[model samples]
Target chain A: MDLIWDGLRKALELLVGLDPEVLGITLLSLKVSGLATLISVVLGMSAAVAVALNEFPGKRLVIALMNTGMGLPPVVVGLFVTVLLWRNGPLGFLGILYTPAAIILAQAVIATPIIAGLGLAALQHLPPELRLQILSLGATRPQLVWLLLREARLPLLAAVMAGFGGVISEVGASIMVGGNLKGSTRVLTTATVMETSRGNFEVAFALSFLLLILAFSVNALLTHLQQSRRPR
Target chain B: MRAPLLEVLELVVHRDRTPVLDIPSLRVGQGEVLALIGPNGAGKSTLLLTLAALLKPAAGTLAYHGEALDTEARRQAYRRRVTMVFQDPLLFDTTVRENIAAGLRLHGVGAEEREQRVAATAAQFGIGGLLDRSARHLSGGEAQRTALARAFALRPELLLLDEPFSALDPPTRGGLLEDLGRILADTGTSALLATHDQAEASRLANRLAVMKGGRILQEGALQQVMNHPEDPFVAVFVGMETLLQCRVATTTEGLLTLALGGHEIIAVGEAEVGDPILVGIRPEHVTLSLHTDKTSSARNQLAGTVTKVIPWGPFHRVELDCGFDLSTWVTPQSLTELALAPGRPVVAAFKATAVHVVRKGHHGGDAAQT
Candidate 1:
């Protein structure tokens, strides 16, 4: 109990005073998560709109595949991405293994499915009249795509936030791909794991506290956008 | 007044391999308000959508401005000249001004012109104040008015309305009808509106087309179709509830005695003796009295018991079973004046002019109609 109280006090001190090492880990985590989120959002939204708007053979199978991917374990994603970038794997010439980019790719793989599945659900929730209205209003296919995407901005934002939350808090993918390289690839979750194993409770607690704040802020913003979109 | 601005040729739609709409050649003339009326699931909406060119017909073609409807370019051109206001006022997630400006935006109209047009049309629909307000906040009537203003701003050559007034209040619907009547006349733009309300059709439309089971049962001028509808469905749709098949016997004095259901009653209509006729009258035209009056202008009177009274707004639609089940619409004040109730004997009287003589057997009676 004494040690826990000491760690909490030290964590509060680091937050208030902005300790360099703690701040470094926090910023690096934000960068990796932000990059991963952007990658996931771009790929996810396109896939979601394609599946939601058009019908083709294997459409149901594609949707089922996305549904399965939504629950993919972070460690599994980490292993899969690591192998793709490994020496024996295809396209290993770039040699991006054990780097921040490798970590971003792994986290993005985990986040993509979550963003896509939720995005597809949001698109499905729109009333049929919306499509009919756009068509009847003489909207070209491209114009309609832009219009629908604009209308679904709030949901899409939520999907992005969800993906961000997934990537930022995940430890398994970051540890395997980032290799916990101090000053280079070290992030919040991996740093916390390393500090805790080394009995550095104060550092771990500070990282944990910062991650909590990041997650809370992102979720709150997403919720605010969603509430604003509710029909008056 | 001429061969119509819009003509639909044998437009047919098949849904799940079943024919949902099968409208053979129909036309709407300039400045004419045509009404397509029917009961629920009568393919009224299907026909309207087909006219709007939102759904390609399974077979047949549509023509506007004497040019065949072919190619997306031609269809888009027609769409510029023709527009539809659907049953629900489907507003976008934008301001009322933006919603009204959508059509002009599609044509790449200048921004200043779009604003001016939106303002003018909004004033016309009495929604000028709602311009800056988001469309999601509009009430049903307000949303409908906004949609109308949007469609009107385009000044389309033809307007297809599918139960546009269904969501509006009575006063709003009435005002809209009056405005629509004036606008269509002033612009010389033809309109085809589908509705189930008899009063709506009678007040707004110059011609009425009664549909049933994906086919038009009757189509002609409103009053002519109402008075001498080709089918029982048309008669019922036109508010003719009391239609009795009778054979006119020799007239005694000025009264024409008719045989109905093994009994004889004096019917109010001008018909030749020995002529088999179907006598029909609107419920509102029928008058009920407890006692016969010699001073009444009614040409005929019949005694019947008040069997059922269905209360409508400000009136009661009383059903009388003398020998045939006949309905009479009377004001609530008149119901009290006559002391009418179920199981009470009363005399139903009406003038000969009110009792329209609808010729029967011309189209093989009610069985062959629908």
Candidate 2:
């Protein structure tokens, strides 16, 4: 009880005092996750549009694979990414291991399927006649896609939020690929893990509190955007 | 005659190895409104979609302005000249103004021109006040109006309407039909409208085509097709409720005498004596009354009992068993004045010209089936 109360008191003090290291870790977490989410959104939405619009052999198999990927274990992804970026691995020629770029690459891989699965669902929920109607309006193929995306903007935004949420709080992949180098690749989740392992309970608590606030603030803004454009 | 603006030759559309539309040569001339009528699942929509270039026929050649649209580039260019309005008013999730302006934008019209056309079409369709409203918030009629405004804003050369008014209430459908008729005439835009309602087809189309079993059974001027349906199936489908199997007894001048049950009726046709003929008469053309004056120009007057009185809006469909079942429509006022009811004796009168005669051997021996 004393440990928890003391931790809480110190956590509040760190937050109020605006600890530079804690702030830096939080900003790094946001920057890496935000960039990963942006990349995933572009790739995921393209895949979703292709999957949702066209009919081809193995379509069901492809969709099943994406759905399976949505719930993939973070530790497993971390393991695979670590092996790929290792010095002797197949892709180590670029020499980007133990760096922030490695963390972003792994996070994007983790979030892509989640955004794509949700985006496909969002597009499929629209009326089937909408595509024909847009074509009847003389829309070219690209314009048709643009108009459909606009029509499905709400659910697509939800997909973005989900992708962002999936990566920001993830510690396993970030630690494995980023190496948690202080003042370089250290993010809020990895820093929290390190502080706890070092018996710095107060700092760990402060980091956890800061992580929650960060996630809440980003999600709150995205949620605001999603709700404001809702149909009356 | 003016060349046809659109021609469909030997078109066949299949769904999973089963052909749904097999139209052999149909044409729509410039400024012509052709209504295609058929029963449910008769492939009217498939035909319309094929004409709109939205559905590619498995086997056919579509000619636009006498040029074959064989390649994708030709088809795409043809599609830009054509537009369609489906039964459901599929509006995008945007403002009504934007929805109406979308097609113009796609056609690469300048923004100022798009706004002008959208504004004009909105006013024309009586949706001016709804321009700024969200499409999701529109009622069915309003959404449909927005859809029409969108289609018309493009000023397509050939408009294809697939039962655009079928999903509305009767009053709304009637109002929209009247406005659509006026719009088509004002713009001189040729169109092919597919619908199941014969009345709508008759009211809006200069020509009518009756489709059945994936084929165009008959096509001609509206009155010609309605009055002289080539087959018994067409007669019955076109709402000619009274079909009687009669044998020709004799001919005098331009009229032929036919034996109906025990009575002799005169109709305008030329059939050999002792030949079976199918006579069709619309219910509305048969007049019913209580007194048998016989002083009018009607050549056939038969007495019978009213077996059924079906209440139609502002009218009644009274079925009489005058040696043969003769269906006739009478106004409610006439019904009340004549005190018409079931089991009451009444006289049904019709002119010789009202009866449409089809030979028994025409169109695959379908005369006996009716």
Candidate 3:
């Protein structure tokens, strides 16, 4: 009980004092997760549209794979990204191992399937006749896709939130691929783990609190957009 | 004659390896309104979609203004001159004004022209007050009105309607039909409408095509097709509820006398003596009265007992057992004035012209003159 009280007081002090190291760690966490979410959204939405609207062999298998990927374990993604970026591994020529770019790639791999699965569901929920109606109005194929995306904007925004939340709060992949280097790759999640391991419970609690606030702020903005209007 | 606005030949559309439409030849002429009437699953919607170029037929040729739309590029270009209004309004999740302006925007109309057309079309459909309202918050009637305004704002050369009013209440459907009739006349836009309502087809179409089982059974002028159905299916489908098998007893001038259930009836037809013919009369063309009047101009009048009275909106369908079962339509006012009820005595009168005569075994062709 004494340790918890000490940790809470330190968390409040770190937040109120505008600690530079804490702020730097929080911003890096946001930047890496934010870029990963953006890349995942672009790739995932395109895959979802193709899968949802077109007919081809193995479509069911592909969808099942996406659903499975939505719940992927982050540790496995971290292992694969680490192997790929190793010096003797297949993609080691660029030498970006233990960098923020490595963390971004790993987080993107963990987030893509989530966005893709949700986006496919959102697009499929629309009435089948809507496509015919739009085409009948002289819309080109690309224009039809644009209009349909607009129609599913609310669910798509939810996908963005889910993707961002998935990567920003994950600690396993960030520690493995980001290496937790001080003043370089140290993020809120890794810093919290390090503080706890070093018996500094107060600083660990402060880092955890900062991570929660970061996730909440991003989610609150996305939820505002998702519920902006009734879609019916 | 002006070239047909649309011509379809040897068209076959399939759904999952089953043919849904197998039309051999059909045409919609310039400035004409053609109604395709059929029962449910009769390929009416499939035909409309095919003509709209939204569905590619498995085997067929579609021509617009004498140009063959055989390629994707050609079909896309032809789509600019055509538009369709589906049964369900299917409005976008936006403001009513934006919904109405969508087609014009796709056609590359400038902002000023698009706004002008959208405002004009909205006012024409009495939806001017709802321009700023979100489409998701509209009533069914308002949504349908916005859809129609959207289709018309494009000012396409051809318009296709797929049961546009089937989902509306009768009064709303009637009012919209009236407005659409006037709009079509004023714009002179050729249109093809598919519906299962016989009355709607008769009121809105200059020509009627009766389809069944993915094939066109008959096509001609509305009155001719209604009065002279080529087959038993068509007779019932076109609302000819009363049919009697009669033997011609005599012929004089342009009229023939037929023996129907030991009674003689006169009809305008071309049947020789002792020839068997089928007589059809629409229920609305038959009038009923409490007493028979000899001075009446109707050629056929028979006394009978009212066997059934089915109430339809503002009207009643009275069935009479006058040696033969005859159905007649009468306004509610007349039904009360004549004291129409089961077992009440009544007289059914009809003109010789109302008796549509057709020879047996002559089906799937133009009406044989009578």
Candidate 4:
């Protein structure tokens, strides 16, 4: 109990003074996760819409693949992305490993399927009358997709939040590909793990507290958006 | 007369391997309004979808301006010229302004022009105030007006409406129908509507096509079909009353005395003495009285037993088994006045002017069925 109280006092002191190390980790996490989510939203939303609206061969298989990918182990994805881009690996020529871009790419890969799956599910839930109404308006295929996406903004936004939460909280891919280099690639989750491993419990507790605050803020904002869009 | 702006030929559709829509041929002139009438699951909606190019026909030809309508590219091009309004209005998650601007944008109307036209249309449809309101928060009538404004903004050459007024109240429907008629006339935009409402059909359509079992059983001028139906289905569909054959015995002051089934009755229609004529009286036109009054405006009066008093709204339909089934509409007040009870003999009365001579055999082989 004394140790915990001492750690809490240290955390409060660090938070009050805007400690550089703690603040730096939080900012970097935000930057990396924000960029990764933007990329995921663009690619995942497009792919999801194509799968949901258009019929094609192997559609069931494709949906099955996405559903399966939703449960992909974080450690396994870390290993896979790391191996492909590490030194002496297939993409070693660009020497991108240990860079922020590497972490962004890995996190985007981890988050894209989540965003896409939710987007597709949201579109499928639309009523048939709504679909017919758009078609009757003489909307072209692209315009129809845009309309459907606008109509499904809530689920799409939820997907983005889920994807952001998934990527920001994940340490395996960030540690493996980002290398957790001090002052360079050390994000909040990785710094938390590193500090805890080194018996720096106060810093770890602070990072954990920050992660909780971030996640809760995002979730709260998402809930507010969803409720605003809901029918009265 | 201008050539038809919309022509559908042999539109046969299959649903779950069963034939659903089999419209052999239908044509709507440049400014004519055609009504497709049928019961539920009668392929009315399917036919409308096919015409709107939303669904492809299994086997048939669709032509606009004598040119074959084929291919998605061609269909989209034709669809831009021809717009379809569904029973339910689809609005996007965005504002009503965006929903109405969808078609205009596709046609490459500039922002200023689009806004101008959309505002004009919104005012026309009485939805100008709802322009900025999100579609997710609109009432049924508001949504319908927004959908119409969107469709009309395209200035479509042909408009297809599928039960557009089915969800609206009577007053709203009447107002919308009047607006639709005026719009079509002003723009010379032809329309093909599919509905089962008789009053709606009679009010809006210049021509009526009776559909049954995936076929157009009868199609022609609405009044002509109503007055002289070729089939019993068409006759009853158009509100044609039952035909009573009577022998004209005498003519007194424009009233003809007819002998019907060994009972003498007065009819108001002109007929030669000794000539057998048909007397038709709508159920609402006939009255029932218990006393054969000394002075009544009614010229035709006959005593008959109230065989059945079926409650129909504020009025009860009194069915008298007078040789054949003679149905008359009488209010509950009259039902009380005559102390009218089933099996009680009462007088069925009507004025000479109320008797109409519906000529026999106008079209089709449906005279016997009616």
Candidate 5:
């Protein structure tokens, strides 16, 4: 019981005092995940629009693969990304392994499918007649896509939140690719793992608490965006 | 005569290698409202899509103002010239003003002109007060009105409507229908409206095309098509009508006495004495009895033999050979109770108010069908 209370007190103290190292880790975690989420959103929305609007063979199979990727194990993604960025691996020429860039690449791989799957679902949930109606209104092909995306903005925001939430909390990819180097590639999740492994429970508890606050704040903003569009 | 504003030739639309719509030849004149009437799955929506160039017909050519839309550029231009509204309003997640202005913006109309046109169309659709309201918060009728206002804001050369009122309540549908008819007349915008409701087709359509099983069963002017359905399916679908071409023998008050096949019948409609008029009788409006009673105040009562009985859904269409040949709808129970079959004698009666009277064109009357 003292352990839990001690961890809570330590977490509150660190939060109140705003430790520079913990804050740095938090900002870096946010920066890497935020960039990764932004990349995923662009790639995912285009892929989703293409898949949702067009008719082609193997469509169901493609969607199934995307849905499967949405739940892909983070550790598995980390393993493949680690191999891909290894010194002797196929993509070693760029030499970006064991760095924050490597972590971003891994996180983006983990988040793109999550965003794409949800974005696709969000678009398909719209009335099927909407596309035809838009086209019949003299909308060009690009304008039609733009209008449809605007109509699906709410659900797509939820998709972005889900993607960010997914990567921000994942430790496997960050630890494997980032190496959890202090003051360099260390993020909240990886730092928490390292501090706990090193018996620095107070710092670990503070990192976890801060990570929770960050995730909740981001998600709360996104949820507000998703629902504020509803008719009162 | 000027070429039709739009013409479709030998059109065939396929879904997965199976043809769904096969229209041989259809044309719409300038400022003409052609109502495609049919039951569910009748390919009315498919035809409208093909006409709008949204669905590429497997076979056929679409022409606008007598020029074929042969190239991609031409087809795109044709599409831009037309607009369509759907059964669902499909409003965007925004204010009604934005929804109404969306098409205008896409058309590259300037902000000032777009606002002007949007307000004008909003007033036309009676949605002027709802411009700033969120589209998501609108009732079904209001949503549809906003949708229609949005389509008209573009001032489309041709408007395509696919059962826009099918989802509304009857009174709402009636109200929208009345307003839309007035608007169509006021704007003189040519439209191709697809609906299953006969009353809607009658109220808004100058020409009616009855479609069944992906084929046009009949197409003609409203009264001609309704009173003289070429196909029996159309006759039954149009409420099994019997038409009569007659001269107004005398006018007394709001009623008229008509001379028919060596018989005199009283009816009600606007006509000067001796004017030729076409009388439309819905089979359901006529009733039959084994013997006529003097107490009945029915205007026309003629004793005749049952010429035919066609089984149409629950009610059977009973054709009578009353000096002028008429048809009436009778239930199976009444059919059995009255022992009505071909060659059976009975008295057929209809009130003066039950018939529809339209002034005849110079082309004269079409042959009556049973």
Candidate 6:
């Protein structure tokens, strides 16, 4: 109990002291996860709207496949992304392996399915007659899509949080694809793993505390947005 | 009518390779409130959607004011000229003001004028106090009022309604119906109201089209369709509750004598002697008398005994056993003055024109006219 207490004391000291190394790792983690979440949102929302609006053959099969993708193992995604970016691989010409870009690419793959599945559900939950009613009001196609998305904005915000939560807390893909290089590719998750493995309990505790704070802050902001506009 | 306001030609709609609607031709004249009435799944809603261009028909040509809506751009432009209200009162998750302003915004109305029109339309619908209230929290009737105000704010050239009052409670439905009837009369806004209630059709429509199995069986003025139903189905659907099967006994110039249960009745219509026909008598057209008057102008007066008295709104339906079963509507005052009761003797009287004759075994391609 004393060791834990001492470790927390030292961690708070490090956080308050504005340690440059800790700050760099935290910012890098945010940058990688934020970019990945943004990419996933764009790709996921487009795919979801396309599937939910139009009816064609194989619709059920496609939805089942997307649901399966939502549970895809991050380690498997890391393995594939590593392979695609490795030297002498098909995409090796870009030479982006063992870098932050590689980690972001892997993280985006991990988040897209989560965002898409939730988005599809959010859009489908609306009343079916709403589309015809809007069109009958003389709305153009783009205006229709905008209005529907606005109606589903609350659920979509939840999708963003879920996507961000999944990617930001993911460590396996970051280590495998990023190589966890010091100062260049290091993030909170990778740094915590490295410090804990080296028996540096105090640093690891600090990093974990920072990670929890970051996740909660981002989610708290989104939750505020999602709930503030609720009907009384 | 010459130079119709809207026309539909050869409209066909299919679902899963099976035809759901196959309207060959129909038209609405200027300033006319045309009602398309039928039972559920009779394609009244589908026809309204098709008229709004929200559903693409398998084959059809739709024209407005003699101008054809042939292309996508033309249809887009045409949509701005009309608005549709659904049965569910589908309002957005916003304030009532925004919900009503949405259509006007889509039509590119300026902000100031949009606000002004929203206010005027809300007041017109008697929802002025609900302008800023959240639509999600409104009662069903208030939500429906918001939906109607939203459509009327556009001041569209044509309005389409799909059972707009069918989902409300009786009192709410009656109030809305009265307000809508008054608004339509004051504005002279051309409209197409789709419903299954004959009372609604009679109250709001200048013309009536009766539909069944995706086809219109008859279409004409309310009185014409109600009195002279060309088809048997139309007779029952139009509230002609009293139908007596009789054989023609004699034919003269523009008149026929029909025999029923050893009784003879005079009717002015076309039919052949010895031909079996069905006589449709509307309950409202049949009057009851305690004593048969020799000076009465009614050609058909039959003595009967009142069997049952069922009280309806403002009137009582008096069932009679006059050799053949018959029913007639009488006001409460008259029911009291005449001392109507079971086993009471009464004379059921109606003019010859009040009875409609439908030739049996003729409801195909063209009714076989004699």
> What TM-score does chain A reach in every model?
0.92, 0.93, 0.94, 0.92, 0.94, 0.96
lDDT of 3 by residue, B1-370 (tens): 6668899999999988899899999999988999999999999999999999999999989999988999899999888889999999989888999999998888889999999999999998989999999999998888899999999998888899999999998889998999898898899999999999999998889999999989998999998898898666788789888877788889999898889888878899787788878878889889998788899999999889999999987788889898988898899889889989999998899999988875453344333111
TM-scores, all candidates, are 0.86, 0.94, 0.93, 0.80, 0.82, 0.93
- Tell me the spans in candidate 3 whose CA falls farther than 4 Å from its real position: A1-9, A15-18, A224-232, B362-370
lDDT of 4 by residue, B42-143 (tens): 778888888888888899999988778877888878877888888877666668888788879878899999999999888888888988898878888888
lDDT score, candidate 4, position B253: 77
What tens digits encode model 3's per-residue C-alpha lDDT throughout A32-80? Answer: 9999999999999999999988989999999999989999999999999
DockQ, per model, reads: 0.28, 0.61, 0.55, 0.31, 0.46, 0.70
Better of 3 and 5 by lDDT: 3
lDDT string, candidate 5, B30-104, tens digits: 889999998899999999988888898999999999999888888878878899999999999899999999989
lDDT of 6 by residue, B312-368 (tens): 988899999999888999999999999999999999998888888864533442322
How well does candidate 2 score on lDDT at residue A185? 96
Q: What is candidate 1's CA lDDT for residue B220?
A: 91
lDDT of 1 by residue, B122-162 (tens): 98878999998999888888898898888888887788898
After superposition on all C-alphas, the RMSD of every candidate to the true structure, in Å, is 3.9, 2.3, 3.2, 5.6, 8.0, 3.1
Q: Is the docking of candidate 6 incorrect, acceptable, medium or high quality?
A: medium
> Worst ten-residue run, lDDT, model 6 chain B?
B361-370
Output the number of the lDDT-best candidate: 3
- The candidate scoring highest on TM-score is 2
Native-vs-model 1 lDDT?
Answer: 0.82
- Model 6 alpha-carbon drift over 4 Å, by segment: A1-8, A228-231, B252-254, B288-297, B305-318, B330-346, B359-370
State how far residue B6 of model 6 sits from its true place (Å).
1.5
Query: lDDT of model 6 at residue B190?
Result: 90
Q: How far is candidate 4 from the true structure (C-alpha RMSD, Å)?
A: 5.6
